[model samples]
Target: MAYRCPTCSPDIMQARETIILVPGLLCDDAVWEHQNAVLSRHYDVIVPQLTRQDSITAMAEYILEVAPERFSIAGHSMGARVALEVWRHAPARVARLALLDTGVHSASADELPKRQALLDISAGKGMTALADVWLPPMVAAGRLKIDIALRERLYAMVERMTPEIHRQQIAALLGRPDARPLLAQISCPVLIGVGSLDQWSPPEQHGVMAADIKHAHYDVFDDSGHMAPMEAPEAVTSALLKWMRDDRGLCK
Candidate 1:
């Protein structure tokens, strides 16, 4: 079965299992370039555009509406929250799940004020100012300073994004509902990954999520931060490939 969307043509394809990858806030498919290249060798990979909707629920709904019948879902940061929403909406449709660098709880009181502050900043100063304030924390310490190419790529990607898109994503993040309560309801295998120094969504948050979810496996990538899949693609790919094969009874 395929879930077709009204805005886009039916992009779903037949495969053993579909893997829908969701990117983080203000991010497009560029974030999953590495994963898509590697994972496509093993399974059909789908990276749906999250631009059609402004809310997390709508994003998840769009993904569900356009995705194949049964698939494994994976997401990062804001995308991870969307993945959880998808699982909550249709648990049976997901064969397995990978929640990367994400948390189950909504932003705390302190966080909420900060997110709102960001909204105000973005509205007043624009995407450039927002990028200046966010890029430092979003990346690992010292990496941006040392790796000129990586830094250029990061900034270029940010430059391509519009302030309006950033505002909508921040709104979604600030308004996201707490997902901890839905953990017990998920019945599929889950893989939770975090970076050792990821301050945005720290390992402790993923640990709590792992503890609560049944059959949830958690891993931490040392020497990496919020952008683990990008910062340490090899490690991320190794873990993901292993999980996918092991869950599907395919030995390599």
Candidate 2:
């Protein structure tokens, strides 16, 4: 279903009991294409554009304003920060939460400088340059050596993104707050997934989160990297379908 906002007329589409997808830093809806396709079979899926805002708070607010009356929300990386902020602003509106390859911890004093440097590079050099520097660590070491076509495809995806939008996303990442204290406040069932080889947000982070949230379940994809939804779509879709059905007792 397509929607034209009553106030701004920005294009918005809703799927039944929508599942809003939030992509990571420097990424667009392209990142969640696989997951969105699979999930749409059973639910309404909305991959909101986060490029319109510069901070996590503003992005969350924009999403809230245009989202369905109630929906399930899932976010990856920077998008996860926005998801948490969305829940913080209106926990009762969320029916379920999925945090994929994300964390609730803030960057440490030691790590802040590195994050800032990346943000600076993204602002100055552009997303292509940043992708060249970032892709190796993002994918598993072995896969990078064995899969040239996949690497090239990923690089091209980043290259196609607008530099200005990428900068806004990086700014949001650097400015996002620590969401640890808010985890316990999430009353809905939460699915925490991570890539075993994702150094950026390791599997242990998901483990810690699963333990903290009263109703959270955790899973780690052994053969995946930071982009689990894209890298292991089958595993991700299977886990998500089971989790949703199990939690809601729907379509069992």
Q: lDDT scores for all predictions?
A: 0.80, 0.79
Which numbered prediction scores highest in TM-score against the true structure?
1
TM-score of 1: 0.88
Q: What is the lDDT of residue 73 in candidate 1?
A: 90
Per-residue lDDT tens digits for candidate 1, residues 1-252, read 333322344574343557898988867677777888998887789988776577889889999999987788999999999999998888878878889998888767787778777777777887678777877787789888987876676677676777677777877787788999998876677889988989888888889999888878798988888988778788888878866754431110
What are the models' TM-scores?
0.88, 0.87
Give the per-residue lDDT of model 2 (tens digit) for 1-252.
443323343565444557899988766787887888888887888988787788899999999998977888889988888999999998878878889998887766676677667667667988777887887888777776788877777787787777678667766776788899998776687889998889888998789988988868889987899988777778887877766654442111
Error of 2 at 102 (Å): 0.8
- Per-candidate RMSD vs. true structure? 6.4, 6.5
C-alpha positional error of residue 74 in candidate 1 after TM-score superposition, expressed in Å: 0.3
Model 2: weakest 10-residue lDDT segment is 1-10
Stretches > 4 Å off in candidate 2: 1-15, 248-252
Pairs of residues clashing in candidate 2: 15-44
